[model samples]
Target chain A: MQPTDLTPHAEPELIVFRDVSVHFPVFNASTRSFRKRVIQVATGGIVAPDHTGHIVVQALTNLNFGIRSGERVALFGHNGAGKTTLLGALSRIYAPTSGSAEISGAVGSLINISLGTDPESTGRENIFLRAAILGLGRDFIQKNLEEIIEFSELGDFIDLPVRTYSSGMQLRLAFAVSTMLRPEILVMDEWLSVGDKNFQSKAAARLDAMLRDTKILVLATHSRDLALRHCNRALWLEHGRIKLDGPVKDVAAAYFGK
Target chain B: MLENLKAAMADIARSRHYASLIHILGWQDMRHRYRRSFLGPFWLVASTAALVATICLILGPMFGLPPEQYVPYVAAGMIVWGLIVSMCTDSCQAFISQSTMIRQTAAPLFTYVARVAWRNTLLFAHNLVIFPVALWISGAHSNMNALLAVPGFLLVLANLAWIGLVLAILSARYRDLPKTIDSVIPVLMFMTPIMWKPEMMPLRIGVKILQFNPFYWMIDLVRVPMMGGIPPGKVWVGAAVVALVGWVVALILFARTRERIVYWL
Candidate 1:
């Protein structure tokens, strides 16, 4: 599928949430245990019941929205407000338990920068693992291996185990690897800042370039300054429901209480 | 129902598209597992050799067979049996081990299942080195019939892949299933003809019961050929049928659970 263009024309909606809701069934030790379940069935006790013993946490509730190409959307919410769940649904990690989540663009997620890095593997090996998990091809990874190493500035330490690296260095590697892909839709839990002040600037510059190039950006964050600066549109989610969807200025004032 | 089946097939196809990822993950899993050990994956070879030696030494006289005859028989059976058992037990961990990856990425579910298959296949390759040595020690000649083990082994792997996928999905939801699989595997090993020959069981019922165990047919497909003999036509038919039927069941389970698997994890 061809990527929807950024140049303004007839804009294609890259993401559509049609009455989407994600409900997670809370399965505790007792509920998840097969032996207990079998015994329950054998005893004819709770077997024929409604099977509603397990509680369900409604993470996203009947969400309705659409994101057009070139729209930069920021998700604003307090804790337990479903910002991350909305991003998860967009990343295709959490399929909607009800309704549909239709994403029509290639998605790159910076939700967890070290999502696929194995600490036991060396820095060089982790580059491959993390990139592959981001859906980058082997050819792309191989060609840019040196560039990534140089960008992350690991140099000689790239050959050492990632577990050996300090936390700052690991984040540098993860941030570098994550930003390598040019996805049409970029999804982030929040803005990523890596390493010391020097590397943080470098990481910020890299992220800016990625944001500039992406056709659509959906970031879930609580920072008001970041929402105003980077996002054109805002979605204020409250208790798994969208409280407001409009210009960043208006939503930020309402949600952040300007 | 048909739509679910189509989606399941699509998931399987996507797994093939991510073959490179599977290969890299599988290789990394094996390497990561033995990184600190000096012998590395060769330890797999060493352990297989030790197990075969222990079993042959103890069971040879009881089965009333000479060292040369019984050693190769037990060796072939154990090699195939090791692959079968490890694949079954490891399948339970296939999804659970990749819980983080499954929750974070859009990678196909079978990619994890195939990773387990690929890693065990590599270990199986290590165990295979013992088979030739076993034959030489038992004073058996290498023959052309051994080449037939390739096709037979492929069939066995196909059956194993589906079984592994099914288990991966089921165990992802039921946390207790893996523990149950752990205990059941040892019992299955003894029930299958790994250490004992079918001839050693004098009871006609016992021999007839072996026919009912699909593990026997799976082992026979690879083991019989490695022993320089063709498996019975029925063995070929049985293994193929099991592969086909198991996959149908596996696909149905996979399709139904593909979306819910991440939540279970």
Candidate 2:
């Protein structure tokens, strides 16, 4: 691992993880009791390395990779193969337990776009609130407010609480707000296929614009077609380690058993 | 230990990084709760004032203080305690309640605690309307000592953050811990000097216990100033000591456990 890869210093063109790994300590639920923990410790039981008897699950172990600026990297693997965790690692949601991950831009994780919307708030309010949760400032949201509302196509319904909107309408409003601004790095769980056919294209267009303006993209998906269509590079993760990393056609062919 | 402290301080440095998000979310919380109501959060003030009136009437004679003196004391006590007690219990779920935010974004964890503390601060402000009116009616002087409550309130807020941080982490890990603390808080309420003053307690037991009850220092720091006098040295020293020790523990715990919080959630 290059020293530059581990440090989050001014490497503007790089998103690097030098031997990054994340381990989750599962505190045994039964021993979580005050008395049980006390009794366990008093008896000199070897509870484990953490001294609390937690069974550690290694989610991502010894992952070494780097995605440069202007590269859209698609992650491919089986479910629970750590594709999502790898994307999460890039998005800054999970700090690496060993080694280090250095992401060099404003990161937007579109894994759950509606994570910020309040059901009780109107569509317009939800748009502002949702964008703010993505770390957009107020002036920017206000400047782009009309464009977001128009893009959602819920003109009159924009004033009503989101709970009143159908789930499709809610998703559209949230998606519009989330993708309105271009982030330096965009991590997506999937292509975010939502809404009716007409709205889906609008969403795709917005996503395309976001992708065009984004400096780095790390997307996780099961669709070989989507990967081939949007990404230039592919990385296949198996049990949290990269099994393959190369150009899209090569890696996807290897991953999909060509 | 020094390295851990530095790490914790660095994590907190992100507080400014997400200051805007915290502010917007905090105000949004208050708005969410009061959105459709006609009376809005004035109902909080109305209800708090009514409780003060009722308690002052019933307990005034029991403590042998006149209505004027007792009303201001209990009112300030009630208002501050409402904020303190609720903030403590609420902190247990600060992370639990925002599990979505925790899982989805890697913003500093302090923002969630700030959100809880700030919302309670807003409510405390709303409940604060009764303090001045109570003081006016009771004819308490507005003196330089009253200005000291500003620092007192700041210390109270500092205490809330650390305590909330520790409780949030522990409870997030052990789901049952919040429940245990939840039930115990109400019992501790009766134990604290909120409904009645320390002077009202029987001398020997009261003085010794009041000196020890950390919660009493929290209330006394605010309650004493509203009646227009400096708090005794013990209140200032006791409250400051608790704040210092509590933050030292909270910061250390946060640095060691901060990364694990996402997994626990």
Candidate 3:
């Protein structure tokens, strides 16, 4: 793909993945010992080398993609079609097995928003932990603590352990803390659908403001309407390959078969 | 190579940002361990006290050693061993416990190991309150040289850091490592000089075997300071070597295979 098509603006390319592939090796549970299994593989034993066991499953195959500064791109794909893997590659959560993925700007991922939050920690404490996991410095979180608490709308619950909060409350707290700090490259994997109707609109406006300041926004979602509303460009991934890549409207139509 | 070490040190120095995160996690872990219980962290002290009492009662008489002498000895050994074993067991689960974080976030992988180490250190600190009590009860001799235990404690912390790094990375890649450590720690406990004094062992066979066991060296290092004695220079040198080698090997492994750890998980 050309640089213009991939990274449209004059802003520098923040993330680039050339011929990236992610493969997971399946292992047999019944194998008596690791050495014996290796020996069996070395010998001419008729051990079934299925993808389910003792074989490799290619999750992403020779994928080529790039995200430029100040651009919001939506990665649309079915389940197990490498959408999350591609987003993970940009965040450096999952390194590409064979190809190079170079990301210049700082990246913040909203995938698994509560991944770093401790169940026994207060919501206020979890904010700091989650912020650090998102690469925000401690001083920054300390400075923005009040704003995060206000945005989360968890007044009294802020001091309670996140485990005490309901799922919606937990999501609000996590999202509020995550968005408190601006990142050069912001990544989201279906974490935006956390708030209620009114809160969703508020969150959407906040996200729009963030997108304006964010150098690059990579979101992986199943929602075509949301992608069209927020993302300037769209990528359609099918079977671990980018089937189509272009303007949001055209890609959404193709993806939805409109 | 020196530049890399400098860079690593710089990274570690700036790690306070990461430490704040670990502080939260460590606090959460400690809280979670005793959330349903009323006693909380005191449970660790109580358990250590009970074990010391039992071992002192049984092993002291069986070995023809006085309770006054063996009580402090076993107490010191058990408390230090508790710290070591806790480090070992917790390090094995370090990466596995934070698999979600590794899979989802772009933060440094070492943060999880630090969380485990910090949590165990907190527990060890709580358990250490018993040391003075045991000393008072047994009337063990106190000396200026015994203050060297502070450095000994730091050495134990450093050893835990190395072990945490190695085990976290290994267990992340190999799912069986937790189980392996579970079985290995019991065997290691027996091999270490926790229950029996090293002098009790016959010189030719048992003493030679204990000499080769690194855990024995570590136990002697910790136990010596509490007993108002100096650890041998050889033990100090050997500990330094083990810490250096363990850190170096762990660093190499982490640099080479850190990227794959998330995928493996």
| The candidate that achieves the highest DockQ relative to the unseen native structure | 1
Candidate 2: tens digits of C-alpha lDDT, residues A203-244: 898889888888888889899999999998999999888899
Model 1 chain B is weakest, by summed lDDT over 10 consecutive residues, at: B136-145
Question: Per-prediction DockQ scores?
Answer: 0.70, 0.46, 0.50
Q: What is candidate 1's lDDT per residue for A143-171, written digit by digit as tens?
A: 99999999999989999999999998999
DockQ of 1: 0.70
- Model 3 regions more than 4 Å off: A1-9, A30-53, B1-16
> What residue runs in model 2 are displaced by over 4 Å at the alpha carbon?
A1-13, A41-46, A49-53, A194-202, B1-4, B31-43, B132-147
Between candidates 1 and 2, the one scoring higher on DockQ is: 1
TM-score of every model?
0.94, 0.88, 0.90
For candidate 2, report its TM-score.
0.88
The top-ranked prediction according to lDDT is 1
Query: Per-residue lDDT tens digits of candidate 3, residues B28-146?
Result: 78988898799998898999999888887787789998766777788888888998898988998888877777787766777788888899889988987877788788666656766
By DockQ thresholds, what CAPRI class is model 2? acceptable
What clash count does candidate 1 reach?
A: 0
Comparing only chain B with the true structure, the TM-scores of all models are: 0.97, 0.94, 0.92
Question: Residue A79: error of model 3 in Å?
Answer: 2.1
True contacts kept of 3: 0.67
For candidate 1, the docking band is medium
